[model samples]
Target: MIEAISTETTKFRHATVGRTGTALLGIGIALLAAVMPLAAQSGDPRMLDKLGEAGERSWDGLLSGAAQITGAGGLLGFGVVLGWMFGREFVDGTITGLFGLPVSRAQIAAAKLIVYLAWAVLVSALIVGALIVGGLALGLGLPPTDTAGGLARQFALGVMTALVALPVAWVATVGRSVLIGVVGAIGLVIAAQVATIGGAGGWFTVAAPALWALSEGDDVSGLQLALLAPLLILVVGVTLHAWRTLQLNR
Candidate 1:
């Protein structure tokens, strides 16, 4: 079982980790790191006005700026990557090859989920690290305690947001197209927006984490946090069942 999973994971990495994708992800992070702090300190009314501060550089300000990038990036990136990863199999007509392997379809699907989750976590870490380093270099006058707590919250938010996107795998598989998954991802973002605007975002599993990340107070309850786990489990279960019973001919 371990060997089969390892082999499948390697194959997944090769198919997804292309030069263009790597370069783009790196460049996005670099730009976010460099641009966020500078924009905060730029003294432009347009920039400072949104930050709600008049030339006050602090960790909270920097993180608030960075959150805009991470929040949107984390949500969108998960959908695109998952959709592409699973959808590519159908696009290339290789999904049929997944049958009759030593590994079960469930295991292969599980391995893909695991790998993508790891990748999301790593990317989130890199984004946070860059933000921290950039904030310090810019001499944002924030205490270490506040900086640590804020970064930790941001990291958790990123992970939770990505996890909620796991159901896109099932969407891609069932629809047998990557485009469907991407569209579904966009739909989710729209739904989250609607929920937030309606003042019920905390009850929404998809929007809760991002909202919590940007919140300065205890807007999200423990029940809301706990709800995320079951949502993830439901999606994983549905996706595994879809893969296990999927008919290649259809």
Candidate 2:
């Protein structure tokens, strides 16, 4: 298993798609975070409704909006990476080569998933670091009393958001297509938005992390957050099964 993980980690280091996606994710969030404050200060009517600020235009609202990016934009970015990692083997006609390896196919798949999750953590940190730099560039003044907690929530939210994307691994492996998994990830995001609007965001694991990050409105419970464990386990199990039982004919 360690060898399998090491091999997957090596492949990840050189994966072009993964690197591009991570770059885009970081740039997109930084731009969005920077713009939020500028737009509000510029009197953009769209920023008039900055939540929790009630109309005063404060740093909390500015920072919170940036943090929420992890929940939404991060989801799609994570999906793209997951799609490429799991689906690339079949797409590159390299799945057949796995048969010669001493490690079980399932072990290889598990290793890939593990490596991806570890990558997710690093991606989340980069995102949060970018946010801080953006905030500093804008001279947001001294950090607010709650700034540290808010950033912490955003960091954890970034990771949890990526975790919720695990099902895309299952989709990619089963469909043997990176595009399919990416579509699945998009569908999941859309569904999360709708569920949040419908007031079920707290109970919906997909929407819970975002709401938690903002720390305002959409109450999430300990029980609801706890549900992520089983969902992830199921996704990982199904994805491993798909890899183990892969059919060359398909």
Candidate 3:
């Protein structure tokens, strides 16, 4: 099982490398978005506040642009990569090769999920790296003032967001196409935003953890975790369903 998983994960590494064009686009968008704020707010005390002070002096345009690039572009890229990871095996009939192995199909599905998630984290790091480089280039300072602990917390939140997003793996596996998964993920995001604005509580908040995490900026708190928990549960449940699907085929 372990060997099978390692082999599956290596395929995704190759996929990520081969799909560098799309990955580079996401990185470039994030870099430009994060830096544009520094250009607009040069020499202003307001720039120092970063996420604070959103009045007339606010770098609203840059902030909005950053959100758009990271949220929209990043999500799209994630969905496509996930789709490819899950879809290619079926497309090329390599899934049967895995079934011929000693490993259980459930293990195969779980391995693919893990591979998809690792890809998500790696891609996210690339995007964040782009943001850091862009910020430094624009003289916006390295790391948030909250320093070690705060940065750690934010990084945790970001990873949580990415991990919770693995339900898209279910979508990719079931849909068998990256395009459908991308559209479905985007639609879910839009729906979650509407639910949040309408004051609909409960599991709806978990529906869009990444959007909330990014929108709240540095406001990481226990409350956000409370809201995000259900979404994580949903990912786990969906993963089980995907595993079950594989097992039944055996």
Candidate 4:
């Protein structure tokens, strides 16, 4: 396990598996969070009204826009990372090398997942931290006391969004192409949008976390969040199986 983990970590350091894309994603989210409030507060009442934020407080608008961007962008960003993590080996024509490693394929896959879990947590924190810094830079003033809970939910939303991207790894591994995994990620996003529009967002795992975050814990039930556990376990289990019994022909 240690060896596998080390090897995967090394690959991340030197490989070209969507790091540029991830960097651009982070920048995009940060920039959007930074500018969205300014746009909302455009100083023209007519413009603010057109944005549907007329008469809203600046801080509230900033926080709300930041949260919305985080919920949506975080999913696609994490998907890019996860898709590359699991499928890069094949894309780079290096998967065959992994077959001969002393470490088991399952261990290698598990190591990738473990690394992703840690990365997800770190990325989630960074997203919130970036927003706070952005808010302060804009002189939005001290956030309201109620803002703490909303921020916490946003942070949780980031991690949950990453977890929701896990199945992209499975899709990548099964399909043996990073493009396939990314397409799967886009599919999930579309499905979530449709599910949310249909009012089943609470019951749908992919849609629930974002909805909960956006609603500030008012909409989605605890049962919906808990349901994510089994789905994740199933995904990871099948992913490991795919690696453990991997064959070249497929």
Candidate 5:
């Protein structure tokens, strides 16, 4: 029994290390791309040249460059990476091997959740850092004042972005298929975007972290907090669901 638990724990740790490596790779790419925008935009330019005549237009190179550099949709990219990590286990039949072990299903699930949360935090930090640095280089300027409130909002953005993984993890465990889980995560992000466009109520923000980041400003209102409440609820639900699913087989 002790050996079984140790083996399962080791597998979980191994999967986490692999995912961390991928997260670092993404960060490295972001770092390299960060310098491209500054170099492209550092030239003498007539602000009022003919509408079409341009030496180095913002749209031509820097805008797209900044987008890629910032890794704006990086959380979604991490979701795909996480899905692939679990998918490997399924492909190698290691998931089945785990079930045959003496560890409680809950322990197995909890281990995965720990890895998931760690991945989310690490990737979110990388993406946020990239965005801040890229934004400064592109002349957006540092966030105003960097006050406590500003810092809080910034930290919240990272946390909310990371929260996305809870649902992804839940879907992965329940479906037992990485492909389905990844597709589901992509669908959820799309649906959140649509909900914002359609003027849906705050409920949409329950699962959408980007919503909070996009909404933050000097004039942010109480209604914004109301919106975040549901997102908190959604996070709790996903965490509970994952726990229950793991406990079932135990």
Candidate 6:
């Protein structure tokens, strides 16, 4: 079990949080930070006009703007990473070698989740740091208390987004392809948009975090937040089961 755990951990670190992934994450943060000041203006002129009264260049505004960018990226990243982690084993035929290992497949799956969670947290922190630095550089006049609160909220939102994306692992495993998992992730984004546009976003687990991050108001209820627990539990359980009983016959 220890061997399996250590091996999976090392693989995840190399694939997801290694130099290349870290560099990409840094570049994404920098791009988001640079565009935050111009977010309201860089898009459609009509949209900017519509946001005229609400879109001041305040700290909260900047956070929301950055969240809008990072939230989508985070979700996409989660899906892509999970897909790669699981699907690559199948593609390379390494999955067949796990049949009689002393370490169970479930443990390997769990290790992947742990590693991905750690990566997600680190990327989220870097994003928040970049936003703070960028806001300060732009003289956005961020009040300390509000800035602290916003940071906490953003951090929580980022973590929750990663948790919510756990099901993509199962999707990748079942489909045996990363492209399918990416498509699943895209489907999720579309569903979130539809739910949000229909005014039921607060009740939807996937949409709730993004909505919360984009708005300063209390858009989500306690019940809504609580629902995410069961969703995560369900996906994790299903994934472990799938990995344990999987028959890799190529």
- lDDT leader: 2
1-250: candidate 1 lDDT, tens digit per residue: 6765676567656764532344344346435645655666666778767656212466776666555555556577678778887777898888878896878888888888887787777766766776666666776644488478888876777678778788789899899898998887787787888998899989998888877877843887889878998988899999999989989778
lDDT of 6 by residue, 46-152 (tens): 76775553345667666766566555676766677777877788777788787777778888888777777887788778767776777777676554785887777
Q: Native-vs-model 4 lDDT?
A: 0.78
The list of candidate 4 runs beyond 4 A from truth reads 16-27, 43-57
Model 4, 172: alpha-carbon shift in Å? 0.3
Candidate 4 residue lDDT tens string, 1-250: 9888887778775766545644544455655767765676568777666555312446556556655766667777788778889888898899999888888899999999988887777766776677677678877776678778766876788788889889999999998998998888888888888998999999999889988876777899999999899999999999999999999876
Q: Write the per-residue lDDT of candidate 5 for residues 118-166, one digit (tens) a residue.
A: 6556655555466456556656566455333433444455555555544
Q: Taking the tens digit of each residue's C-alpha lDDT, what string does model 3 give over 72-150?
A: 4554555555556666766667766766778776677778777666656665566556655655565556655543343
Q: Using alpha carbons, what is the TM-score of model 4?
A: 0.90
| Each model's total of backbone clashes | 0, 0, 0, 0, 1, 0
Against the reference, the lDDT scores of all candidates come to 0.73, 0.81, 0.56, 0.78, 0.51, 0.74
Model 1 whole-model lDDT (C-alpha atoms): 0.73
Q: Identify the superior model by lDDT, candidate 1 or candidate 5.
A: 1
Model 2, residue 94: distance off in Å is: 0.7
Task: Report the number of backbone clashes for model 2.
Answer: 0
Candidate 2, residues 71-149, lDDT tens digits: the string is 7888988988998898888888999999888999999999999999898888778877787777777777666777777
Model 2 vs. true fold: TM: 0.92
lDDT of 2 at 74: 84
Model 2 alpha-carbon drift over 4 Å, by segment: 50-58, 142-145, 216-218
Residue pair clashes in candidate 1: none
